[model samples]
Target: MKKIVSFTIMAVLIMGAAVMNGDYVSAASVDGLNDKINELEKKKDKIDEKQGKLSDKQKNTEEKMAKNKDKQAKVNNEINSIDQKLTKTRNKIQAKESEITETNQEIESLTGQIKSMKKKIENLKKEIKVLKERIEQREKLLKDRLRAIQSNGGSMRYIEVILGSQSFGDFISRSTAVNTIMDQDEDIMQTHMAEKREVQNKKSEVVNKKKQIEQKKKEVEQKKASLQNQKQDLESLTSKLNNQMSEKEQLMGELKEEHQKMEKYKMSVAEKQQALSDQAAVIAEAKEKASSEKERLKQLAEKREREAKQQKENSSSTSGSGSAAPSSSGGASTASSGGSGIFIWPASGSVSSGYGGRDLGYHYGIDLAPGYGAPVHAAASGVVTRSAVSSSYGNVIYIYHPQYDKSTVYAHLSSRSVSLGQSVSTGQTIGAVGNTGNSYGAHLHFEVHEGPWNYHSGINPFPYLP
Candidate 1:
């Protein structure tokens, strides 16, 4: 894969150097540094916005929780009130049942009394009718007797019945007898009529009483039915209130969890803020130094390349030209010829360390781990880039290949076999191997480049190498 390391290396190398110290200007001047600082401030503003959004979410969650709590409290009250009403209604229903029982007994008693009154009224009416018939029969008999007397030359008149009687004593006797009979008949009839009236009156009064009791019973029943309905309503309300309480409990639990999350986020933001502060300071400083040192580094590279070319020309004078192995891999033909744009293999070894991900400090090169001091070949000949010793990556060599107008870097070299600007072949020996800066053992740290040692602009070597 191509080493994806492209950078304005000539400038950024100088920035890295300045950052090691506080007061150095790099390839990009102080104006550039201020601009970078402004950029960092913009990042801080974004972080603030993010923190505000989280805080707002926390507040909104809390407000919702509070409302749910209030609703729960009201629900609880309703539940309690409903329970009370249910108890009262149940008691009322029981009381109504007892009243209904008593009212039923009273109605039964009134019915029996009416039955007895009906029997008595029937007997009295029969007696009154008999008495009326007796009076009519007696009147007819008296009229017949009076007619017989009148035909037998006897007359009965109001005066005869009084003064024209055979004697005043006889008239008094006749009047007494008539008056007595009339009195007895009237007495019988009056007693019988009076009894009937009394019975009828009693029956009417009893029926009215029964009706009154029934109406009272209906009212009581209606009230009881109302109470029962109220009781059912209360029960339903109580159940709803209970559910509300349960929901409130759940909301409270959620609220607690939310509060905890808010705290955790706040702590995380604080830590992130501190990290950002440190990073800004470091990047600003590094950005400055990286600019200047990178240029000097490139200049040093050009110097080495000129020297390597001279070495190659001198070697051709002494030994004609070194014959390389035939190109075995397809498309690897005539890779190095007269420096007319062909890249030589800098070393003979297996290629390694392809590149891509940007998170780790980027690697702009390939690593070729070979047996110690195995001949390092020039890959598709070009002038040498540089050979140096340093930190992180030590004993490094840079080669500017002619084919693609690209530079290649080799590090951790045990020894160098060429000078700067030295032209080499596709498989010319360039260096040996040894353990160098930040190296575990003898190996070749190789790289390809476009212009110089800008680590940012390089692609992985795996895709490009033959």
Candidate 2:
């Protein structure tokens, strides 16, 4: 009997040790899960910070692009003005060229007139010379005739001829002959004077015509010179305008290049943000699982402790009764907290905006405005697919329900209390509603999707909600 009691005591000690060992293992597992969750939280924080910086950078880039657009507009206006000036300047230059051509033609015409007048002057001079020579010859011939008559017995010979006439008929005939000779000499003198006066007048007229034509040719040349100078000035101005336009165009091209670079950089930032979000989501999912496991293990450890205590108490009480040891009980059964194909309100608020056409544009979701920082709940029990910050969605969450083959989205959150891949029950608090990500006020933007969540692919959620 003493051996049996000692053996029974030894057996109780061993069973108690086994139960304590199981409890210790579960505790260690819970601690390790806690450590993992902390690590994941730190990673999520880092990703959030990165996302914030990216959003700021994107805003800055957009501001720069807006300024660039303004500058481009100004440059375009300047270019347009320059183009107009260039057009006018070119037109003026064309007109000047035409004037220059006309001036040249006038000069040519004047030159021809001047040349013709000069030729006429030369001809008149030649005629004058010939007329002077003929006058001198005629005067000398008349003087020679007078000398010949004088040498042959002058006036007395004429008187002798008239006295030598034999009858009255002969005297009358001699007198008539002498008168006719006097009349002929006077007529020759008058003709010589008239011819000399006519030649002088023609020479003077030709000289005056030549002078007029030369003056006109000089004026036309001066006009042509003025036109050429004007054309040169216009050409210079046109060149300057063209250069200015080229500079403006070059500036515009540079701005456009810069804009493209900025856009590419912005795209890169967005991509990085997305990658980081994905990474964070993955970490969150792990963390959520770890957390859930930690809780489960903690509960299991407590249960084991209670069982061990009860067994030890019973062993102490029945140590001498010779009773058999009780077998250990099974673990606590886990209940499914999955979706039931029933939707609920995601938030407590009045609907500020409805789904579909809105004043701003097409709205695929509904906006609910509660007080600021109101708790945002899940619409149904589902697994969290995404929980991340976004440029447009801000602090957002997406959940997918397998029962209904549908998804739900909650956006514009101030803070999130859930993690990716975490199972959530209907009306579970997942976040807080506040102004974030394209929101004008403190509100929750909620949506329901028939399938997986996609941008602007939500159906009206009102019908699903009671």
Candidate 3:
């Protein structure tokens, strides 16, 4: 009986020690699982914080984009107004030219009329000279007749001749002959005077006509000069208007380019936000998985504790309780550490402008000039979200990093080497720098965003660039 009691005591001690060992193993497994759950929760918290920052950035960017669009619309209206004014100015110039041509033609016609009048005046002067000569001849003839009459003893000689007549018939003949000669001389003098007066009147009329023609010609010439001066003024004004139109067109082009850029940026931002939402879903799923695993671990720990307690109770009784070994059958999965938000330089160059307000309003990217056709590289490993020509950015590319919940943009490219949905690694060549879109010189415009690519989502790129 003593030997049997000793064996029983040894068996009881062994069984108790085995039960305690099982309890210790169960506690250790539960502690390890708890640590894994805490780590997963920490990761999820970090993701939440990042998501919150991105959401705020999205809101601000959207507001800024709306304001920019409004300003762009106003600029477009102004450009259209300038175009209308330019068209009207051009029409006025054309009308002025036509008026000048017509005025020149009238002046030419008046010049011909003045030449004809001058020729007519010369012919009239010739006719007046002939009339003057005829008048002088008639006057000399009258003088000669008077001289002859005097030589013949004038009126007394005529009376004596009539008194000395031998017969009455002879006396009558002498009286009749003297009267006829005097009458003839008087008639000749009157005819000469009349012809002279008529010629003088005709000459005077022609002279008046010439004077009128000359006055008309002078007026026409003056008109022509005025027209010429007007034409010159109009041409000058037209030239000025053309210059103004050219300047306005340039301004409008710049404004349009800027507007397009803003629009593209807004679109990119919106897309990035969608990507973020998708990433958030993934993170939520991961958190849910972690929660499920934690619950499983807790249940397993409780079950092991219950079994250990039951084993202890059975071991204290008179009967021996067979205890099964604790089995640990759980696994933990960890997420990969994503991008650090640091980037390689997309192009080899010096920074020309930084993110912030500028002459053109809020600028969301950095400008780098390295001459034309400089190779542009990816800042980080990502999937190409966009790769195509943009009216404002030229050949541009957008890269999205799901792991980091961030996006990058490269603008003003001469050529694009990547395509949408293409995967790219860090420092991979994606395009070439250029002076396209709203850019004034050959350069690269790059941007980074913590969330989606939005107008206000951009941070200073220098901090993230090498």
- Pick the lDDT winner: 2
lDDT of 1 by residue, 53-166 (tens): 656755665666566566657656665665666566567656756665666676567666656766766765676567557656766766776687688666445345556558
Per-residue lDDT of candidate 3, residues 251-332 (tens digit) = 7677667756656766655555554444344335444544564465467668767877787887878567566564643222
Tell me the tens digit of each residue's lDDT in model 2 across 181-268. 7688788788788887888788778877777777787788788888888888898899999999999999999988988878777765
TM-score of each: 0.29, 0.55, 0.52
Candidate 2 at 106: error in angstroms? 1.3
Off by over 4 Å in 2: 1-30, 149-181, 292-466
Question: Which scores greater on lDDT, model 2 or model 3?
Answer: 2
Say which candidate scores most in TM-score. 2
Ranking by TM-score: 2, 3, 1
Model 3 Cα displacement at 144 (Å)?
A: 3.6
- Best first by lDDT, ranked: 2, 3, 1
User: Which clashing pairs does model 3 show?
Assistant: 269-453
Tell how far residue 116 is off in model 2, in angstroms: 2.2
lDDT of each: 0.56, 0.74, 0.69
TM-score of 3: 0.52
Which residue pairs show backbone clashes in model 2?
none
